[model samples]
Structures are given as C-alpha cells and as structure tokens.
Target: MTTRYIDAGVNLTSSQFDDARDDIVMRAKQAGVDNMLLIGTNTQDSMHCLQLARHYGFVCTSGIHPHDAKSTQADYIAQLKTLFLHPEVVAVGECGLDFNRNFSPRSEQISVLSQQLELAEQNNLPVYLHERDAFDAMRAQLEQVKVHGVLHCFTGDKHALDFYLHYGLMIGITGWVCDERRGAQLQQLVPLIPDDRLLIETDAPYLLPRTLKPKPKSRRNEPAFVEAIVREVARLRGQSCEHVAKISHANFQRLFITRRGTQ
Candidate 1:
C-alpha cells in the first residue's frame, strides 16, 4: 500500500531531531508518514526546521510558539520574515495564547500574538495557531485578522470548534485525541469537524499516544508516531484510515500547497 502522510506539527529542534536523517525518515516510514511539517518554537528553531525540510524534502512551517510570546520583539518579526522567504516554510506560526500556563504575562502574549498576526497578514503567509484555556481571548485577537491557516493541536469543545469553523479555519488534531481519559470527548467530537476542515499531526517531541507499543526509553515523541493519531481518528469517525488520509492529504494540499500555483 502507498502512504502519503503529513506530520503537520513536529519539533526539528528537539534532541531526537539530531538523529540522522536516514534514521528519522526510516522511522517515519515505519509509521507510514512520508511528509512532515516541522514546528519551530522560535527564530532559531524555525531556521533549523526549514533547513532540515530542505535536506529531507519534507514540508515545514516557521512556528513561533506561544511559550516564547514574552520575548517576542520587532527583531523577531524581522527574523520571521527572512524565514518565510523559504518556500519550505509554509506557515507563520505555532503562535497563539495559552492561559493555562500563564507562563508569559497576558499583556506580552497579546502584544506578540498581535504582531505575529500582522506579520502573517502582511506577508500573506498561512498561520498555525496554538490555544489552550484562553479561547475567548484568542477569538478576540483573531477577530482583527483574516486567517489563512489552522488552529493546530486543537482540543477544545464544540463551541470553540464551531467558532473556528465559522472563521473558515482548519484544525490539526494530535495524539491527545487518543487519550482514553482526556481524549474520550474528542473521540465523539472529532468527527464533527468537517472533512474539508480536518487534518492530522504528531506535535512530536510531545503528546505521545498510549497505544504506542513498547514505548521509547525516554518516551519522547516523533513524526513516525503520527499514524496512531490518524488511525484513532478514523476509528472515532467510523471511517477507513485510508479515507481519512485521502481527505487530509487533500486538505493539506489545499491549505499549504496551492493549486496550479495560485491561491
């Protein structure tokens, strides 16, 4: 069987990322993932992501993770602009708000998110947003910009899901969906996500699924593990994994790879 997979959210800067390319890609092949969208949590991470993508011929995104929001500055945007110049850097963020941690002050989060949104707008780059326990604040921030991307690693309930649906934003689901305890809700809820608006990811170096057989020694996640997410989503939706793959592949193409080189 032929598999065309997109590991939509992964960390190329992780220690695991230093594993040789052939080893990394081989493991991904084991999980049936052929394509990857590596996440860059900062300017440095994003550069490494783009460079690795070029080397591996994998798709990638320039991710400015919400955790770094406090330190985000004008120079950050300048650095991001340079990263976006690479065709492999398909999106402008992993950027958004996370009230759950409150690691960064709300003001700093708002300021940085605002600047990143404007950066996405001005550069015409698609966005990859991250939100946790701050749905209302995130929605308010998004209200000011036209979105051209997804709310990645989505874990919200129906209302939050519906709000993004109205905004015409796509979603990227991760291994968190397979958690029998916390993810039980998603088992029912994920199917509600329209086919066109759905996609799958690993969020590697994080969110490892329990179903994984003989877990890694350190238990760090990787792109190869994304198949567990895809399979679990299919089970929840009562559809074949192949069907899920086809639709998500189409969604990825639509969102990141423009048709006929046009938007």
Candidate 2:
C-alpha cells in the first residue's frame, strides 16, 4: 500500500504560492500528502486560509501570530471568533511568543497569546502554536489555560520538549530535521516524542529540506516535501516511513479533524 501523509502545518496563503496554488496542492496529493492545516497569522490571512481550506477540502487555523501581535486591532478576538464559526478553522493559532525577532513588543505578544489561549479554551478548540526563544513565557501562559495543540515546527531542546509533552501538546517536526548540522539536535530528539503526539509539517515557502536532491531552484518549500520530513523522522526513530506517515496522519485527524466531527 502507498504511504499517505497529512502536513500538519502549511502557509498556503503565502504570496510565494501566487498563481501556482492549484499545482502545489496537486503535487502534494501526488506525493501522498492528502491533507494539510493551512496556517493563519491574522484575521485577513485566517480568512484567506479558510477560503483555501474550503476550496481544497483541507482544514485551517484562525488566530494572530506573535509577529503581528503589535498590530492586532482592538476587535481582533471578535474577528477570530467570527472565523471560528466556520468548521474549517480547526485550531487557534500560528500564535505564540517569538522573542527571537521581537517584531512585536514582548508585552503585546504575551497579551495577544493569552487572549487567543482563552479563545481556544472557551471554544474547546486545539491551538496551533509557534514559539521561539520564549519557551519560558510560553510555558507560563500554557500553565494558566487548558489548551491542547501542536507546537508547530518545534526546534527546542529536551527540557522544552518534556514540558510540552507533559502539558499534552503534540510535537510538530519539519524539514529542519533533514539538515545535518542545524538539525543535529532535532534528529536526536525525534525519537523521544511519543507516536500519538507526533505531527509533521512543511511550513512551506520556507525551510526546504536540505537533503532533497535536485533541489528546486526557487528553494521554496511546499506540502509535497512533507514526504521527506516523514522519511527522515522515520529513520531517526528507527521506524519505517509508512509507520511514521500513518501515525502522523492519524494524529492530525485526532487533533484537528476527528475532534471537530469532520472526518
């Protein structure tokens, strides 16, 4: 049987996709990735993601990303709530703290993240999180709420991984695992994530797997490349690619689709 996959996160709304969106989705399906969670960083992007999800029969997220936290309007929560009314919007993020760039003030990031967490809890929806150099703040915020979701594109160390796992969030690994040097740590940590909590994403238009041969000249990542990520993850965990693909597909369903009574 052919192995199938679900790319747990994808920025399908990115301008980088431009006119090739249809081809991109087709290529992903041809490569065995049948479903994807389109990430939304703000109200406008969230709506675009939802439209794409509806058109392509995929799920998506609805929340503001930390980088945009500073510009979040006074009624941003209201906007998110409106987006959540659509079942295609499964999780509450692409949202979290990013002290690494600090494009938004630390205070704004915290406040916006806290509000989104509350929205997730109130709606009983899982959160699709992003964190970079802000694990401590992320952990502190998570402690105050009962939210569950994937920490998309996780690159943190064992301590962060342990806390997220214990807190009941799924782990999302990306093409970063395919890099020999920068990915060294992630490769070592891949085996530690439990099967039930493991998810894989492309974070497309970014993080192209360095291991891909005949690399695309544009260097733009896409959902189809999730196959490479799965294979690498399988190798790291000493398991078959089919097993990793199956479990990640199942995990995505459980966290986003199944719980929402959609597939």
Instruction: Please state the error at residue 50 of candidate 1 in Å.
Output: 1.3
Residue 105 lDDT (model 1): 90
What TM-score goes with each of the models?
0.94, 0.98
- 1-263: candidate 2 lDDT, tens digit per residue: 88899999999999999979999999999998889999999999999999999999999999999999999999999999899889898999999999999999999999999999999998899999999999999999999999989999999999999999999999999999999999999999999999999999999989999988879988899999898888899999999999999999999989998898852
Cα lDDT computed for each candidate against the true fold: 0.83, 0.94
Q: Across residues 174-249, which tens digit of lDDT does each residue of candidate 1 receive?
A: 9999899998877778989989999898888889988778788868888887778888999998988888888888
Prediction 2 global C-alpha lDDT: 0.94
lDDT, model 1, position 34:
69
